[model samples]
Target: MSEPVSALQGAIFEGLVKVEEAGPCGMITLRGDLASTQVKTAATGVAGVDFPGQGEANCAGDKGLCWMSPDEILVLCPYDQAGAGVAAIDKLLAGTHYLATNVSDARARFVVSGLDAREVLAKLTPADMSPAGFAPGRFRRTRLAQVPAAFWMRDEHMFEVICFRSVAQYVFDILTAAATPGSEVGFF
Candidate 1:
């Protein structure tokens, strides 16, 4: 098999904040009973974070897990480890009714960093991006303009956004436009 590359090849737009297409990030769409100890142990062991609560994203080092829904979780790890990550989880819950699929290549990741990053994202997503409302560690699976997307904070000034690979450019376009130098909303 050939090596995988990101949907957008090093795309970057720096305005009020820096909007850049990030490198491949390993993602796993893990669906099962979030409340089961068997399921929770298998997932957290692989992702390196305790399973996140509703709308929460918890991480340890470069690995993490995001709570997508009551029965769904998004697993994150190094881009190259996604396949193994899935296999490990599968093996751990072999007899359970669970599904762990590697979705690393189907998604695109973008990094928006700067003081105005939250405002840049606020323009595109309806989620409360306010400092006190949507604090770090919160994961939002919402619409970025017309497309479905998800985003979380890396720090006070840096946010990471993810969307389907097919709509990467559109998402990037809207993000950059929202980050235009004179368009700062100062909402955060």
Candidate 2:
């Protein structure tokens, strides 16, 4: 008998592809409208490592961490560190006007890396992926395959694509089709 398809299975449809993992390595969502200074101060105090400023991506390196935004960040530490990281942030910004919600389980992340990564993205995204357009170390909240996703440019050939967990599979399928070999559609 044939095996049933699991919801989490990573399928290769066309050229667009998705990783096996459903969500990111780790994620934290921060909400609140605060002054830039307040947000920076809170983030710096909470982060064991340096925080990336606007238009920058901070690599925690051995610490296994990355900051996603001025108000939000994603750490790649082991599962055990998730709780501690959130707590530290909570403690540091105790008096600040902000809301921090641990959303590690709410979103899905896929590492789309390859020579054709940008090309595949171009199919679904309206943003320009050219070097002059979206440079490396940049990230943008955009739609991918008609799904709301945040695209983090890891390098010239790689991107960290994130989307909601519920529509992750659909997004993946769209990406696969765009990445199919010999497809004329250019994503980047």
TM of each candidate vs. truth = 0.97, 0.76
Candidate 1 accuracy as TM-score? 0.97
* Each prediction's whole-model lDDT (CA): 0.90, 0.61
Residue 132 C-alpha lDDT in model 1: 87
Residue-pair clashes, model 1: 0
lDDT of 1 by residue, 52-165 (tens): 889999866668999899999999999889989999998899988999999999999999999899889888888888898787899999999999999888788988889999
The residue-level lDDT of candidate 2 at 60 comes to 52
Model 1 misplaced stretches (Cα beyond 4 Å): none
**Candidate 2 stretches greater than 4 Å from native:** 1-24, 32-38, 41-49, 60-78, 184-188
> Tens digits of per-residue lDDT for model 2 on 28-123?
555544345655554444444565545555445323334455555554443345567678767767886777766656677677877777777877
lDDT: worst 10-residue window of model 2: 14-23
Model 2 lDDT vs. the true structure? Answer: 0.61
